[model samples]
Target: MSAAAPPVSSRLFSLFCLASYLLSLSYGSTFLLSLLIGSRGGNELDAGSVISAAMLSTFAAVIVSGHLSDLLGAARSIALFSLLLVVASLGFALTPGFGNLLLFFGLMLGLGWGVFYTLGPIIVASLVTPAQRAKYFALLSGSMMTGIGSGPLLGRAASALGYPVTAAFYLAALASLIGALLFWRLDVQLKKTPSASASVARISWHATARVLSSRAVFPIIMVGLGGCVFGGLSSFQTSYAASRSLDYSLFFFGFMGAAISSRMLIAGFVVKRDPLRASCLLSGLMMVSILMFGFVVDDGFSYVLAAMMLGVGYGLTYSVINGLAANEAPSGTTSQSLLLFSLSYFVGVFGFPLLAGRIIVEHGMVTLLLTVLTIALLNWLITVGRLIWRHVSRIKTLQQA
Candidate 1:
């Protein structure tokens, strides 16, 4: 019933295509980091450091960007940050050495990444009404998941083409360029057309804090618990996929291909129905997918299937919870609550995966997978517990009334 729920036209729909592409590039550029390093004579440790650097940067700055989305329009901020990403991609692809690599990939690249994520969800909320957010968010999630799911295959193609890192970086940069342009165009459109529903108030920090502290916090926590499994996959998918002897960028890309396809196809429909329930369902899928992947040895079909399932799980869940936060967020509190949500998710992404990697070292692959499954199971339990609590509380209130 919010005024934001006006009928969307085809042109409005075009905005999603751009979102998908930009997210795809963001993921793609990061996916091929290992190949970039390997091509330049770096070793596994070096590659690990670079990847960590980016994640570190992303986790550290998400809040700042989220807060800043108020001063800077989400669309404009994303566009400008993406421009930085383009430069960083070029820097990593064209430059040399561990220090310079860290400089661009760690700092510039991370900050650019910070911008994309910060603005992305806010803009997503802006595009849809509170009630509609789950469905639209799912669509955007699918687009991003589908695009990035194509990562390993695209990485392989780059490697095969003789300049693996360069090729992938170029494609990612191109995709991002289009995304930036589309975002800019969206900004322009907003300025010129002027929706009958005037814009909501700028995002508010005080409002954001309360939303972050709401009843919805439980679901966000549950998702974070479940997200540990995906975090592991994102970190090691490329390096793990490639030959120990040869840097096969295709390994991770192939895995991404399967994951993205499933997301793009099913995510929108899933969210449209009931985003919260869809996320709950995805928690189950996460258990199955992580369990299946525990057995994957090298870059193979099992790994692909596992990746696909993880993609499904993530695609199914992320935006649902995000939509919930956006919906429950007060009139002017979009960015902060979402920032809190991102912080929770990224913490899992950056920290747990590192733990998993250590598990990979100590416990072996199958055991490591079991760890992931355990994490998923933890999430499932969290969801059930919270739902039960809500149900019981409602029943008690009804009895009292």
Candidate 2:
């Protein structure tokens, strides 16, 4: 026996694993519908805008939702949010007439994701030990990737079945329903735990304000910036696929699948090692990956490269930052810290792709790719510089002491 591998919370790992599976299923089902819409008549700019609008919804709602979690607690918030997601996804499929795709999708998506973005991490935190976060997060990533990696293939399936974009919406709703069910169960389990049952006074917004202004905030923000850049450019992956004359839905497979798998393996290892150093290394890789996207003249070859690079960046770097943000969160500040971390990252998701959309429409794909390269490189440099500064400062302090 391997000393029984020590005691572990099955509930915590199970919840993360289950949630990951459901969310990926939801991602796969909905993403294909969105792509189908783009294929029908939506231009790259339009498609990009629509997707960004949905992300914008989550971005906008993250803070308030998180703050709410601190008051009502993670389990309740998660339950409420996951329910909303299920309803919204189902209702969106039924919403027939479309005019301003951006406005409608954005509002609905924001509402749905706001709930998810706000509570998912808080729930995970409640379930696991602080030290176990990286490993758990990796497990979550892997589960999600295993499901999400198959998202594009959902499109292939939809296309084969001749399901229109509208029909795909119904399928997405089904996936969301499954995910919501898992979340509901997870919330119930969380509430049953002795740890979660203890009463703590609700966190006031005034104190919340102070927590966000601390030293750790800087590191969190820096990590968030890098995340945002990576996320924002990714918002255009579907559009980029369309531009290449390849199947837009299929393109997601290459990137997301690789990303999901990479994180599954890397998150735990780096978290246990030096999370910050892992972040720096991954940041360099991300910059190289983004820059590599710029030189792809051949559509097929470039996608393969792009997918591998993205997977590596996401697996190694994305995991590092996520782990660090959670690991470094201060007392009574986990909700706020995770939410803020999410907020900055989404700002990238909302802003970066919109910029890319404009670039794709006005400047062209090559220009857009180059622009992504520039932004990613800038983020990489700033992040790297900060890590070096932090390391040197720590060494000097020790020497002086």
Candidate 3:
């Protein structure tokens, strides 16, 4: 007897896991590059600019592709975007010099990342039932965290192979190819039974802009601010450690380890009911973690503890926000909402770090931390305050009517 093949749902789930992993790996690999770019006679701010540029590219792709996914279909769009990842990975591995890295890694690869990250959840959302949304969403986040956690380790291993640093890009390229193949297979499976959502009528650009700018959508946007926090921490943690004479490797180990664990534990709590409540809870934790990052200067234990706090905060925050966005997406604008949510996140991931880099250059890391902390604090207050006010107003209106 032949072995049984896995069901389509299982296959798509696995593909999603692989795609998310590659995305993390690509990002982690770039994390290492950011450090090296500074040491290679380049300014830290310049290196940060490169990362920001890539994210900017991702930002553009996300806004455009979110709507495109509705028209061309998610699986096909993912496969199409994965091809760019593959090419960019190869270019990063083979190209020599900083300018090329910016061209391929920052711009081209960012475009691929924007589309893949935005659509991965949409594809998964279409595959599962409403009851399974939170569970599957958590699973996706877990897979992504695992990949991100391991990416730095993989880059370190590649560096140990006695090859030029570009070899890490080669390793990342191989992973990208694997991801592309997985997405292609997923596309084939999705073609079997077309998703009901696959046929949502395409909204015009003006409508897309209005949905993104609306007040009702602002809370979800606030929830997505976790991306900026995550971005700032990931991009600058190494430098922060160097400034304090702490070990970068140990700090990252603690951060990723805590993040992976927290995501697993928090996954069960992200149910469909009350996703906003979950978002509020996670946002508070994130604010606390950001505060802790400011004091990790002298003691090793504090550094590790701060990393753990950051991990837990970052992990749960992302999961909760994405879940909330999915639940709150409009009847015909689910894809658009998700895209907007992702757009807000990438803006933080890329945009915040870019701003922070400039601040660090002029005022030092202390000022940078203070600035971030202030912003995080304000965001928490506004997010929670508005949510409560809106809820009470809704109740009063219902009673009066």
Error of 3 at 264 (Å): 2.6
Give the TM-score of each candidate.
Answer: 0.83, 0.84, 0.86
Q: Comparing candidate 1 with candidate 2, which one achieves the higher TM-score? A: 2
Residues 1-401, model 2: lDDT tens digits = 12222334686667657765665554444444435545556555665565567666775566467465667666555555655555545554554443474357556655666566546655555556676666766666567656655655665676679965555555555666677666666655666665442322234566457556665565466655664565545556666666667665444666666676566565556677776667667777777766666665247766666666766766566556666676566666665666676666666655455566677779887887776666666656766777788889999999999
Which regions of candidate 1 fall more than 4 Å away from where they truly are?
35-45, 59-61, 66-72, 97-100, 193-205, 242-269, 272-276, 296-300, 330-332, 350-367, 398-401
The lDDT leader among the candidates is 3
Candidate 3 lDDT over residue span 1-401, tens digit each: 01232223665577678777876666666666556666565555766776787776887787677566767777667777777776766765555556645655677768887888888777766666545666777778778777766666665565577666666667777787777777777665676644424532233686566666655376456744666677777777767877888766666777778866765665675554475566567677767777777864477888888777777766766766666566555555666666777677778777777777787788888888887777677667766886798899999999999
In lDDT terms, how accurate is model 3? 0.68
The residue-by-residue lDDT of candidate 1 on 1-401, one tens digit each, is 35655555557656755565565665555656555666677644455456555667776567567445556556677777777777776676677665654554556666676667655665666655666667666666656665665544566676567855566676777777887888877776654433322333333566656776775576568657755766666656555544333343333444455445555676557666654456678777877777666554344555656666666666666766777766665555665666666666656654565566566556655666677778788887766776677789999999999
Best by TM-score: 3
Total clashes in model 3, counting residue pairs 3 or more apart in sequence or in different chains: 0
Clashing pairs in 2: 53-106, 57-110, 58-110
Instruction: Quote the positional error of residue 374 for candidate 2 in Å.
Output: 2.1
C-alpha root-mean-square deviation, each candidate: 3.7, 4.0, 4.5
